[model samples]
Target: MEFTETLLPGVGVRYDGQSRDGQPIAIVVAHDGDVEIVTYQRTDPDAVQYRLELAAHAALAVAELLGSPRVSARLVDLTREIPGLHTRRLVVAPGSRYAGRLLGDSKARTRTGCSIVAVVRGPDVIAAPAPDFTLLAGDTLIAIGSERGLEALAELLGLTPDDPVPVMTAPV
Candidate 1:
């Protein structure tokens, strides 16, 4: 549909969590990157959903429209979505060999979709660290990537997504 999905600066806002029934609701983002929730008495939320579907139908009616998602060569070539594309955090122990394994074995990140953005060691911080940067004890790794990527890192780092990091002293 010639959707400008590459419009990297776009944003989406919605109410989520177990509190909501998992309905797809739409919210607005201002030109300044602020999120505004969609509420009642303003635009009919249900009607808005219907209108979006109708717009999709109209788009489908176009003879030249392509419904399938296609990856752009530039996106794949640059891997623009891998670096600062998304972010997650990992608090590793003061010292661990996992640091070597992560940067040494990038395929795990490539496959799972996570990239180490930076490492916070105590009061000092290193941003855009090289792949060879060795991790020290009490190092906080700032990572970014897809959900699966985050999960893979968690597994390798031996911590749950929300668990407090314990000292990794179990002999590597």
Candidate 2:
């Protein structure tokens, strides 16, 4: 589906699109993290059907439920916005060496030139985790760097380079 973005100037940005079923929908993202989801009546395009508003934090919780694919999609969009940079999700397995080790122990950033921007542990997201933070099994590390750096980081984490890592960018 295609979406049209309209800048609200003093407010925020609005994205207008049609749902797969041909329902008119508009998503407005405010500067302060408020989100408004508006749907229009099918019979009367200009008439309102219903509107749902979500606070920033709430929207994030919803996003988590929607899973990492959506996040990856956004990351793919990010890759398009910035040339050459890439993002990938690395899952820490139960048998991995870094399963119970500190973040600094892997020296991931220094060794692979990739920064672990966030760690998704279950329902919680640890943003910009410090080196002292302990990594647990099942923790999904969100890292950003050059593609080769990402591959190196995966290797450093004891994970095979081809093990389900969602490459954020297509082959160029």
Candidate 3:
């Protein structure tokens, strides 16, 4: 989908786009962190059907809910472009050996050939995290590597070969 962005001078900005079904949609954010979402009628795209306004925090929550899956899919596609490369989302379980350790301490990349590209903690996404980033229990790690490398990384994260890697899901 193509999005058109317009600056609102002293105000924040406005972003407009059309849904796959051809309905016009827009989001206008104010400088004070207020977000207004406008939906146009399907029958007449120029007609405003509804408008929902939300606080900055609420808008961020909604965005994350709607965007996480797409981000994961894009990551997978990027990895697939290179031969023998793969992408996996691994959660740090409570009992995992690396649960409370720093990423650099685990030397995951050196030991398993897998590099962590992002860390999903609650509603926040830390992309290209540094080695000093802590790996806490319940954090979902986005790692990229070869199949064998991913398996090794999983083992290092305290997951057995028989354990099924959970698919990346929107954070609660």
RMSD of each: 14.0, 8.7, 11.9
Stretches of candidate 2 off by over 4 Å are 1-61, 64-74, 159-172
* TM-score of every model versus the real structure: 0.39, 0.54, 0.54
Whole-structure CA lDDT of model 1: 0.47
Error of 1 at 155 (Å): 0.8
Encode model 3's per-residue lDDT on 81-171: one tens digit a residue: 7878889888888988777779887678877778899998877888888988998999989999888888877777885335564343221
Clashes of 1: 5
Candidate 2 per-residue lDDT, tens place, 55-94, comes to 9778667777766334544565577589889998898988
Which lDDT tens digits does candidate 1 get at residues 15-97?
A: 32221654444444333334333323236544433212223234324312443221122223245445535455576653343
lDDT value for model 2: 0.79
> How displaced is residue 10 in candidate 2, in Å?
29
lDDT of each: 0.47, 0.79, 0.78
Assess the local accuracy of residue 76 in candidate 3 as a C-alpha lDDT between 0 and 100: 55
Determine which window of 10 residues in candidate 3 has minimal summed lDDT.
163-172
Instruction: Arrange candidates by lDDT, descending.
Output: 2, 3, 1
